[model samples]
Target chain A: MSRADTAGSGERMKVVVTRNLGPDVMPLLQERKELDLVVWPEDRPCEREWFLQNVPGATGVIVMLSDKVNQELYEAAGPTLKIVSTMSVGYEHIDLQGAAQRNIRVGYTPDVLTDAVADISIMLALMAGRNVRETTELVARGDWPNTAWAPYGFVGPQLSANWVHPTRTAGFLGFGRISKATLARLVPFGFTDCVYTSNPSSTPNPAADAETARTYGLRSVRRVGLPELAAQSDVVFVLAPGGAATHHVVDAAFLRGMKSTAVLVNTARGTLVDSDALATALRERWIWGAGVDVVEGEPHVGREHPLVREPRCVVLPHIASATIETRLGMATTAAKNLLGALFGEAMPAEVQM
Target chain B: MSRADTAGSGERMKVVVTRNLGPDVMPLLQERKELDLVVWPEDRPCEREWFLQNVPGATGVIVMLSDKVNQELYEAAGPTLKIVSTMSVGYEHIDLQGAAQRNIRVGYTPDVLTDAVADISIMLALMAGRNVRETTELVARGDWPNTAWAPYGFVGPQLSANWVHPTRTAGFLGFGRISKATLARLVPFGFTDCVYTSNPSSTPNPAADAETARTYGLRSVRRVGLPELAAQSDVVFVLAPGGAATHHVVDAAFLRGMKSTAVLVNTARGTLVDSDALATALRERWIWGAGVDVVEGEPHVGREHPLVREPRCVVLPHIASATIETRLGMATTAAKNLLGALFGEAMPAEVQM
Candidate 1:
């Protein structure tokens, strides 16, 4: 069927947006009169039924990580769908094989989120090490006036390397773009040494590690096994991908191995850490503290959640890439990806299938 | 009185300690058999009466910022007191002139706290810019699941510069050690320009500013007036000294002049910012948000305090130096200074009047 059969002239095409893209980014799609647009009314994730019904005749669609783009959704869109654009770097929710079978291009927002996530990672490290949550809560609860100033009161391990620990070491579970960005930020904090573990399938590159160390002016940067990463690091960052293969990577055993003064930061994915085990670790002082932006089954994490209830854990709802600059960039990239794929122009960032 | 009169047959010198230094630093003072140490029993600031009563015939006193070292105390201690060592960088609470007149060497912990304060300053900047306090509070309150994930949902101005805004600017109220260290951290976040205001007594150093700009790969680092700093800065850091000269420096006019998207961080002194004006500014959206580690009349900031009640402000209980490593260094330095002054080995960090 032609565009005329749907609602307008043959030049007009239907494009469905999974959620509101806000005033800054909506105009990019709305300005194109040739495209008929449908935005889900809710500020929250769109209903699956509404998406399925609306996407049936759509030539393109924009989605978020919360929205799964799988075989059923592809079948619902039929032959009209040419592209699926997601406003996130991670495409785990999308079925790449299914999309490839349908010859549909997948566009995702990346590179733009690096700074925001990196900022959050460093913030977590500081918050965890400084005990920002507990200490701030005390002040908010009207306890500041009564609390006496003591020499060692409210003290926690410092994030920066100092003369006391002249050779402070940093560890990363996955030394990807965000982790590298975090390392760059920490260099000014007086961190001198570094260790990381990448994907098990990938080979270690000593040359690249050495170059990274020299570039950052660090004492050393080397790949390490999980135990060494846990035992030696002053601060450990979990920045690896989330999937079954990496589930519970930072479990009881891993937490047990961490130094009592070390801090753990997870700005990547929740599934990589075991929430219950981490809570226990914090309770037992197996590790000093944790700062996590994501938790297992997030958006459903209540006050009763293990990590949420952990006094030493700084749990934030998933907002690692929640900066105005980043979200706008993601939305614009998503819109541009859809517009480009629809018009036969090359996508600015297409995910390889 | 001679050493024999002060203690047991010249075997020990009388020393008054205002509070118990923790395990990591206690040994530095305790290991000296030549010192007869009298530690204030409570884990709080030693009362003035108790301190006065115990300081008599003491050769040295180790104190915190909360302790007042006035002329009366100096006279009360008589000619025996040789040193007043404070475990803080700030010495406003101490009577420096009185100490000098009494021939009492003043030692303070500086340099050691620079990294900790600088770390907190950046943490506040990021927290304010990203709305971490409000967003995380929502999550902690179990309201996150209901909150929508709109593209602009928890979005705030990014701390880093990007293609859209290639020149991000950072402003400092004081260009001191902490401010420079904070600037170092911001450079990695993509801040390209900096403006700061130093003490009026300080001579303008164009060469140093130029060198700093080049070292950080920044576009410029010029000393600017309050109005220009307020208007041009994307993030204004109130890091000036806390006294009459700098009190209420970030007042209503300054807040009003700031960009609505800008963030204000105060990790130095709370008096530098007008709490009521800042609260009103945040309430009225005159500015984006603020993160304050220090508040005016602190240790007394209750829930009813305007800054504490402001939703956009993230308040901490004056914990910029609340890091284990920094605090330990401070305690050790204070102890060493006392030991040095008492033994006539030249105080390592003597505060010259």
Candidate 2:
């Protein structure tokens, strides 16, 4: 029975929220008297069976990266589900084909997270370049008391360009919005040249690339093959989309081609980089260090993981977009997307199926 | 009498090097046949007695930050010492009055290190804001395999300006070259306004401040009092000159007035921040977090240190200027400074006593 029938009011549609959005954004969904909100009680990822059971008879669903929006979910929701809103930029977990076939619109947050992820990317680069992980570990382990100062001690390659190495080059694995934002940050660090690789399916726009170069005051910002990018870049940022075709793109050969002083930052996907190869390269001094926000099978990544064991590698728990403002923005966008789709209005950020 | 005279070549003047200047730059001084060089062989700090014994008849000395240039050292070197060249920006250890009385020129490496220090300041800011130290420790301790993903698990305040906070304000304890470079960096991250403190001895220039604001595209870059800076800033950066006047300037009262969401960064000298007060502030959540490169009594900072023990604080081993390019530049400058003062040439970066 509809909530309207039981309470003697107008018909209220059911909306399933996989997790409770915080006070700042959750009320947008909760305060909608026309909607009956069923939120997952816990802060953590909900159990699959619980989600499958709770999604029944829902007109809309608000999800996170941890949620799986597949055929099973669509079948459970039947014809009532109009939209599946996710509080993330990536929708790899969602079964887009099934959602499309079911005519369920999918909304994913993107632009709001660009600045936050870009900020973390630079943070990772600096942490890795300066040996923050190892040195901080030393201090935490109470080893700093005995270590005397040395002139060349703890010195790493400079990120900023100077008279010694006046030209600094930055490379992006996937030059998308987040990568471009990262490039903007690098401009102030004295990066003069840029290179990137986009999906092979996308056409190159030399005019647009030249415009971007001019906009950022860079010497060049061009498309380059993997080998050339590996060879030329002083710092290589992996900011591409993650999936089957791009898996292990930064394998042994790519690591071998990188300069000994070059730093590798992977804020995109763990699968794009070969963790074993990166570990071996760091151990062998083939590359200076690496800073990664995501791992191949993250949250499951332990001390035994190759990248985690790599002394020079800095691994964060996939927190590139965990900033308060970005998360709140994402949550609010997801809420708005859900509200829009359920009430027969234009979705704020609907994905193409 | 010199080594060259003993070898039947030419009379040589002795120069004492407190530490090895490394192979890349040491040759700049060693190649000069007119000088007899006495270098302390170890990579660590030179012993006081070793420095004293070697400085007896030296014409010049190349020192590091660890070396204390005092009355005793000056008396040991006697009238033969023409210059003291240090590979550091801070020269508080040097007795300026004694050096001036003896007519000994002082040369310090400054501008070369500005970028390196600025880079680390930003790194510390991000690290502290994002809880890098704690999260990375969780991964290091092998707890990640069991931990499930949660929405609010690692959320911290965002560093970027957003719709919620339309204009981010950055505060500088002392706005000098490093602070300005840091401000230039923050501009790309969407920081809209800046406030800083000038030396009490200098007159405030509203015209110059307005020019800086225009140059950086900031709303304002005005000089403010400590209390206002503490209250108004979203992120407060302690970049002041460290000595008696500036010591403990960011103590309890300043910390109390700060927003709980504000991040405090100290890439300047350690003494400018009161460690115990900061620890209390962090522990009590009076501030969001702190990222510090220097500490009140660093190198001696153990696990027992208040700031070191604070979970929210990111403490580095005083490596603000520890980048290869900057260090090499500083070494080259120190070497050239000695060469210049000894040979009647203009010193590249001499400090007038």
Candidate 3:
């Protein structure tokens, strides 16, 4: 009944798009004559009820990270849904087990955003390391007229290696695609050593690490424990996944172990780091500074948030992959995945379950 | 008489230091029995009257950029000033022509702070291109609570080359040591092409450009005219030397030639870019955005400044070389240069007249 109300023709397959994919990508869906598209006209998140009501009788659904694919939604769709394409690299919102049992293909954008995440990770590192938060605020406060340049004024640790620092090390909490891309970025900044802590359950391969070292032309690329990662790194990048197992991995003890001159950058999940511990560390000068793109309870992170109140802490609203090119690539990929699954073709970047 | 009043001994040479060289370097001047050092006690700039009164019988003086070396100062030094060691790379404050005419050896810190400048240059580029000013303030203003994620919310241009964009080009107004260091930093970002504009009076060495490309692993590094540079580059870095010859090199016409997606970064000097023109360009979207560490009539740039008021412009307080390591290196260089000049060894980084 909902499908009949939304779709122009009952003969054509129904495809529900949660948001406009923009002119560059919407054309891909609009050009198709064999399908009827039911796109959400609003810019904000499609209301849950609206999404559920519209998803019914849809053969394919294009969703965002906010959209969750569950058994209830599947049941509501009445076995017509062949695919659930999400325009994000993350798939935590989608229930893979339920989708697999229901014989549905799950499509997600992955490699297209690797560069964006890596670029912003390095950006946060540089911003935090160089005191961008305090310095920029000073400019905004009209303090330039009174703040004369001093020898050591607003000084922070240099991110690049010079003659004095012939070798620099970069640490990663997770050495996956995003982390490796970040490592690639550090090489040009003259990073000599690369240490990372990966999934504890995964098998360690020194040979793979050696090959990585060879590829990046680094002195060594090895998998180290979390403590070693905190202690040895000049700049630590938190790029691990979000979950119970990785919750508060960067806690008080870990923060205490970091070098006073070192900078901490997190473009990963905020659950991987404890905000209170980080605030205390910054207040005590345990670490030089921190730049984080995500928080434990983000979207609710306010001016009164502990990390936001810290002068040395730079907080961003979870926008690690917020670049036009990356978003377009994701939208295009999502559209293609939707079209592919609707016509029974292999979907690009489909989650294997 | 002023020197005798300040110094304890008549036999020793008086060395006037305008500011504390910090703990690591002050001992270098303090330990020497042959010199009588009159160091300023305050953290702020040394009063001009105090400097003039103290330099009367001094053999050497270590000055900052705020202290100018001129004819009147030379006349007041009573012909005993052997060297003017400045703890900065730029010698614009020093009257080089006057120093050369008087045969006073000028020592400056050079070949250091290159990495600092380059590091901050990239940092500014990333910050400006990525809507940092708008987004960071949004978080700081407690706006994150209501700003839910949208399909293309807060999207910006991608700095690094992605799968779709296989090549990226970087432009420079001046291609010198600092510019080269900045170029080295961009390689990891997947910049394949490099274009630059040098002194028009200088010879165009295609061979040297090719060698530079080879060294950086870039596809092509060539010298182009100003208009071509603005048109072709994805990012333009203003790193040329400051003075009349290069004043306001990035004016309205040059900015108009640039791509709408381009980002302009100026780490060299305030005079190299026109603040009003840049503000207008940003306001009209002539170019994506701009990041400048220096502004014209600096130490005076307030909230009402045109560039400061623009949301797209990211302004810094000329802290491009504001890193502890770089500052220490500069102080040490200045101290060593002073010691080297006083002892009559080859003064490190001396200005050749």
Candidate 4:
């Protein structure tokens, strides 16, 4: 999509923001004299009908992941809509083909969230492998006095290398930017090896893998099949993108292949793992434990949630990137993408179509 | 204690263990042809009366931290008692002066458990800083759907460095082996500065501080006063040894001076931190949050415990060194110490009186 002709014509255009992005990012949209901004005033999700009515004449729209950017929404905005910027990396809800046909450029916030997400990934790994949920609950439920420490009372697998375990291995279901960042955190824990599985059709890149090993001072960093990854990893991290091909990739067979002492952590999309299968694995002790920030059908998870019922399973709401600094970065980048697209400037992180 | 005359002469000296050390380590005692092993058969803490009865005429005794080794124990064991080996680093429960007067050597495990304890220090820091307790409880209570992600729903302070936070600082209350190991884990998180407080009576060593900084690739690693430590640190770690001199070192005034964004983690002895002061700090928001493995009075920390009731405060049972490998190492070390003293070999770790 080329620069819009409506930009800098002294013409006033309407801009709809799905929600107020707090003090740090709202000014980016409100300060524009050439654009009249209409923002949803509530702290909850913006209503669809109300959004459709306010977005009719909008030249650009800034939206959260919950706000769908579909064909019907595009038609409601008419040909005046030049772009849709989302405050998330995933754009599965957005109709890319329909937007491209209408010359609508899409912008997303991605790399800005890598470090925040990676930090939580490591946190979950520790919590899962170290019996944190069970241990903390023992204290909170007033059962600590009765459940006094025996020599092996609450013992779990150690995450870091010890005299008994001089070499540690970290595995990734998908080796992307966040995965690499998580692996970097493990180097100091004396992790000597790394195994990962990426898109199978893509050619292997040993040169890149060797360079990564050298950078982290690791003994080896090699790509492998899922079975090998499951068998070799002390901790398996599911960080692949969510979609049709990747759905339930960590299924019963994959879980069955894992070491009984291994830990599973998922910070990626919930659909990438089979929730019931994971629950069964934890129940049967096929795997040591799990820690998940994203669970299938989240926000609907309740007390009966199988993972929640498992004491060793540390289940958290989807908050992998909910840090103050990272959230501001995401919101600011999202706002800039919309402003830049409408003002004939380059979008900071545009999806190439 | 010198080489026992009873050993290897088939004199059949009695050896008493306060509690069973499990199959892996039980063989060390059971296989000694010159010894008669009498182990307390229960998983619970050995009864004091049973221990006193079984200890008479024993050449060596192995005990847990919970077992008290005092004048009564020495009198019960008579002049034949040569050593007491404890499967713990701290020996305050054992009367050192009394044991020295009785000419009994003391052995305790220390450095073998360092990595396990240090690993949990980082886990607690992440849990404290990242709102793990509140967020997990929200999901567990089925309040997630109503409290679904708004722009800033569950935001927290990030632990790792980013463009906005280019440098991260890690603070330690005591500069010791465990503190240094914890600092090594922080290097990959992009921590650039480290501030620590050690014994003030000792002279400062700039050359040693510089060497530490270089080793971790940090910009600075220097000893600071407690006030400066509270003011400058992003996360304060209490890793100092706990005793009368350091009791309640993290009092109200020190907590008030800390950054509102800083997190405090206590993996060392709980006596160093005042429970009521920490609860008030959380209530008043003087500091962000805290994660603690020990409490001022443990095994007595019920639901009403001040720190346990705080949403941001993550309290765990004292399981920092409760890992399969670490516990095994401690048990083996304790057993070896007793065997070495009885058989005239060097004890792996012996306390000097």
Question: What tens-digit string does per-residue lDDT give for candidate 2 at A93-139?
Answer: 89999988888889989899899899999998888889888789888
lDDT of candidate 4 over A224-334, digit per residue (tens)? 998999999999999999999899999999999999989999999999999999999999999999999998888788888888888778998899989999999999999
Best by TM-score: 4
Candidate 3 ranges beyond 4 A from true positions = A1-10, B1-10
Per-residue error for A247 in candidate 4, Å, reads: 0.3
Q: Rate the local accuracy (lDDT) of all candidates.
A: 0.89, 0.89, 0.90, 0.90
Candidate 2 has an lDDT of 0.89
Indicate the docking level reached by candidate 2: medium
lDDT at B36 for candidate 1? 89
Docking class of 4: medium
Q: Between which residue pairs do clashes occur in model 2?
A: none
Off by over 4 Å in 1: A1-11, B1-11
- CA displacement after TM-score superposition, residue A147 of candidate 4 (Å): 2.1
What's the residue-level lDDT of B130 in candidate 2? 89
To one decimal place, how large is model 4's interface RMSD in Å?
1.1
Off by over 4 Å in 4: A1-8, B1-9
- Supply the DockQ value of model 2: 0.77
